[model samples]
Target: MSQATKTIQEINERIRKGTAVILTAEEMVDVVRAKGKSAAAREVDVVTTGTFSPMCSSGMLFNFGQEPPLIKASKVWLGNVPCHAGLAAVDAYLGCTEPSEDDPLNKVHPGRFLYGGGHVIEDLLRGKAVRLKCQAYGTDCYPRRELDKSVTLADLKSAELLNPRNCYQSYNVAVNTGSRVIYTYMGPLKPGMRNANYATAGQLSPLFNDPFLRTIGMGTKIWLGGGTGWVIGAGTQHNPKPQRNERGIPLTASGTLMLKGDMKGMSAKWVRGVSILGYGCSLSVGVGIPIPILDEEMAWFTGVSDADITMPVRDYGHDYPNGVNNVLAQPTFEELKSGEIAVNGQKVRTVPLTSYALSLEIAQELKAKIEKGEFLLTEAQDRIPSK
Candidate 1:
């Protein structure tokens, strides 16, 4: 079957099931007159009621205003309708086509009616757009000599780059012919991970021979880079006490620290100190850059804010209880060529209004202009007020 034929069949099936029907223009105005503005605003509930009904009848049903007169058709039977039928009636009234079986729209599941509907509308009104960053540490070490306080060539070749003691050497050498001896300390370590030796005051004398060669500090820095993921240290994991900023906003140390600038891609240095047989390692200090995401307004609406009215209506599955009659009751007009009413704001579409207040106002103005002979009506049949 042609696409349009299939759509029409679907709509007819909905009507046969007794779903709510959209009001004609005249019916819309009457509903508004019966229900005051305040009560009309609450019509969303009435719409909900029809959505859950079990009878298959299609017509504009008003909640606040005088209920529309019941229409009886000799050929049409009314009573006991299924939920699908009710939904179909709504679709027919709105002149909307159901997504095909294979379409993604058909796959979407329904959520809470109000919130889901609002969210859909909001998405339609605003354009959708999403942003993503990764980072690591680097460390290095080298060796020095104990004799003559200078780096030994042999020690340099075998020295563990990560070990401080292996990388550097201390020694005493006789200078000139005098009794004085010069003490020197030397070693520029390259970056890496390795083992190092530590010398105490007494141990230094045995390793260096000269009593002048004594103990010194034992520590080294190594460059560390890429890992499985970002790591947070204990200091950050368990902050002692929360600190407040100048604005009195409390800051927690136990949060992800972002790296800054080029540091995000660059390696960091890790410093380790030798003690006993094992080495104590600490993370290298570095800065990080925070990745930017959505703009403030969009973020607030999509993320933190709680407002419901801003959400869209289409996302809610376009299930209008009152159907196309409800749409026609308001501002919608049937296009002679397409047999569909052009919706306002959106590319020709339709929406359900709780009451016909706006439509009535427009009709009244048109009547007045017509009485004043502002323009001529081409078709006398069309000039008649729609019931």
Candidate 2:
């Protein structure tokens, strides 16, 4: 392939003129197969990728209005879920996995987690009433000590969905080879490798289409919970260097993203509360990213299919908890998506925590937005560090 490249400005101009060629990540694979990667690069302007899955590292930041007499809040709770009020007087941060203060976690039965912080966020987004309780010490300028009230999303001064880590590039396939059943964040795994669960959008994943994090970095625009958002920076535990196959796709967890957006502009459908059988509650978020076809190399990367991507299979029951770096097998996404994969000569059923159909719809929606000039690709202000 020659060193042909397309600039973001050029693509934006085409989009403004209603002539930009946009395709979903799934469609790019076929186009690259029919024509060559070089030809596809010159023909296509942008490729959209999407994922909708339970991201536990998500949370919300809220600024409740100051109360009468102006007391300094020391502790805050929403719908019985605790929130960190270590910031200013009315500023608090609610983590997704924070269980309710009165929740009978695992008391009734093993893995009987019911309510948590994720549910509270969902309730607020749906315009449902949530009870807010706060405690504050009397200050010189403040007099009130304790307060309790009901609030909704509209009542908050500002609400922002701030996720420290999200959009894992590739993840492990969780399975159980132990004697008894085990509950994990991946889901309930049956004994003797009866079931396997994986989380990722495979080829439709944003990072999978940009294995090297070439175009995705700080300040890149993205679709977050059906609203516009931006990548803040490299997420926590971001492992840029990981084991990869000959195709340059990571075989395990790799890149991650720090995403933030306005909560009022989001939809409850995409930002949902999820309760795991044994694990605590987490938020399932919809994320879509647009990749500009800058050159032939980017075209090749975006053309990757499920058949070309691979993931590591790990025993969640024992090895994961024990922190053992052992891989049972490496299976392609195509095999896992087939609803079954062979592990240690035994056939195991495969399941996904994410919705592939919904992710595809998000990609299609992003494509339409770009085609209508409602969305434009933004060059990264700073690229994420590989280290």
Candidate 3:
């Protein structure tokens, strides 16, 4: 068998045994290219391997000219090893094994667990039950209030802190009426509430459409509501955005609940409630590629022409937005070395040597960790155990 085939087989075996594994950018790129872009894009749900590396000093240049690619394959296997397993069994994959003293790759600390790509793929295949946590805080952003002004669990429920609608309302600005202070929500204020100018339960319509509010109340008895209270101003204008919950649901529960009539301190404006929005928080942002994984086989045929293949070809010329020629003319190592290519106006040779060293270090660490069992598969039973 070819060395590549052997490597793939070994990786698969480790995954079957429930070990952690890491895939090099080169290995990942090869697999994806082999499977075709459309197929690979569809099969791989999340791409997170690049997050750990350093950003490029040269804005337009791809960090590592060519390196291992990280991918969450459509198969369940150990993260530390490469192997062929069905996509359904991927959840068992875990991150690199615990870092050791001598490990240089361990130098970069792992942040929050971002479960997507193969992670999400595994979840879908396994049909896992997910839960979200909800909590409350004051306008000043203090989670817990002072003793005299201490908020209670009962106060939270009574004031509809657990309500989804109220919890998700955006409170960009704080409402202050001399000494009458009102808490602010997370986002922009709702239109009805802003125009009403009065702190009334009826004005809390915007909260009704917030998904953050509904997510926190899923399978729970929580209701969230918040809006700008009446603020006396000489001539201040209040223009609230059209009330539309981004997630298409209120943050509060819509179900009926029994409440005591004599519940005290249940002020509509002062009582801030919070509920679960959903399983995960969604974000919109721009991402950069710190490494480029080129298929050696394809690269060989494409010839050497490194003119910044990392940059999207469409940006170079309008006619070649998806042109095959534009793609082919991309800068290669030969072009870069022969003074035929320039990145961000600077010749490739002018690029700092430290950058290459760092890229090499990153590649070495990733490979070593995979070999040493850094990324492994998590047991499905542990995430969502069978009854």
In terms of lDDT, the best-performing candidate is 2
Candidate 2 structure quality by residue, lDDT tens digits, 1-387: 336488888998999999999999999999998997889998999999999999999999999898677867899999999999999888999998888877776567645668888889999999998988999887887677887999999999999999999999899899999999888889999999999999999889999998888889999999999999999999998997898877679978888999999999998989988889877789999999999998999999999999999999999888999999799999999999999999988999999998999999999999999999999889899989653
Q: Candidate 1: global Cα-lDDT?
A: 0.17
* Cα TM-score of candidate 2: 0.97
lDDT of each: 0.17, 0.91, 0.22
Candidate 1: segments with Cα more than 4 A from true spot:
1-95, 100-105, 110-354, 377-387
Q: Where does model 3 exceed 4 Å of error?
A: 1-12, 15-329, 337-354, 377-387
303: Cα error in model 2, Å: 0.1
lDDT of 3 by residue, 167-272 (tens): 1121111111122222221112222122101110111121221211211121221111111111011111211232332322211122121111111322222221
| TM-score-better candidate, 1 vs 3 | 3
- Screening candidate 2 with a backbone cut-off below 3 angstroms (N, C-alpha, C), the clashing residue pairs are none
Query: After superposing candidate 2, which stretches have Cα over 4 Å from the reference?
Result: 1-4, 104-107
Worst 10 residues of 1 by lDDT: 47-56
Candidate 1 scores a C-alpha RMSD against the true structure in Å of: 41.9
Candidate 1 lDDT over 149-243, as tens digits, reads 12211211121111101101111110111132211111111111011111111111111111111111111011111101121111112222334
Backbone clash numbers for all candidates listed: 61, 0, 76
